[model samples]
Target: MTDALDRIRSIALLLPEVEERVSHGQPTFFVAGKQFAQFRDDHHGDGRVAVCVRTSGMDEQAMLLDAAPDTYSRPAYLGPSGWVAVNVAADDVDWALVEDRVARSWELAAPARLLEAGGR
Candidate 1:
């Protein structure tokens, strides 16, 4: 993987049965029919790629907001219920974290059926 798309694609590779597609005007990767992560470029003109992680509503907002206000933002309009957006700015973000989140997203979205089927 080269950029955010590549990074996300890499993470998707860890799961058994998952698919990638464009949805809601962005590149979205899904597992077992549920969306785990979505990739977004800062703007059509810019080259920065942003990755959004869907967290449990239980996620602590105050700290997340304080730590990296710029890289971390609301998960789109849905930032309210528990989704946090983390910048995967290709050049700066720690890819390992992104990879980990992607892995978790797959686990979160992948249904039990797919998990049991198990295959590359």
Candidate 2:
């Protein structure tokens, strides 16, 4: 569990101008002061450890949730805003998928200049 969290942190921080901070008692990744992703550990006693990130839009969110119920879900509070949660604690954790989600979230929150720089 700790390993997974560490891996998430590493991937999120590697994004351009990303910073990690504690918000609502959870580790949140921000780009240009806007939140993109958050690490939730048993959030609100739900007993699920996952990374919640912003999606391209509601359609993307619905597609992911329908495609992988076990791996993805609509996070509370943020779901209506097109945010999706990826279950990091699943038995078959897909780090590549996680990285992609983080990257997309970063791109969504990043400034135009950062995105124009290729977001490397």
RMSD of each: 3.4, 0.8
- Residue 14 shift from truth in candidate 1, angstroms: 2.9
Model 1 over residues 41-113: C-alpha lDDT tens digits?
A: 7645445467776665545645676777876777656467666676776367787777776676676677777
The TM-score of predicted model 1 comes to 0.75
The C-alpha stretches of model 2 lying farther than 4 A from their native spots are none
- Which one wins on TM-score? 2
* Model 1 accuracy (lDDT, Cα): 0.69
lDDT of 2 at 22: 97
Best by lDDT: 2
The TM-scores of all predictions, comma-separated, are 0.75, 0.96
> lDDT tens digits, residues 1-120, model 2?
788789999999888888899998989999999999999988888888999999999999999999999999888788999999999997889899999989989998899999898886
Candidate 2: residue pairs that collide: none
Residue 46 of model 1: what lDDT?
48
Candidates' C-alpha lDDT: 0.69, 0.92
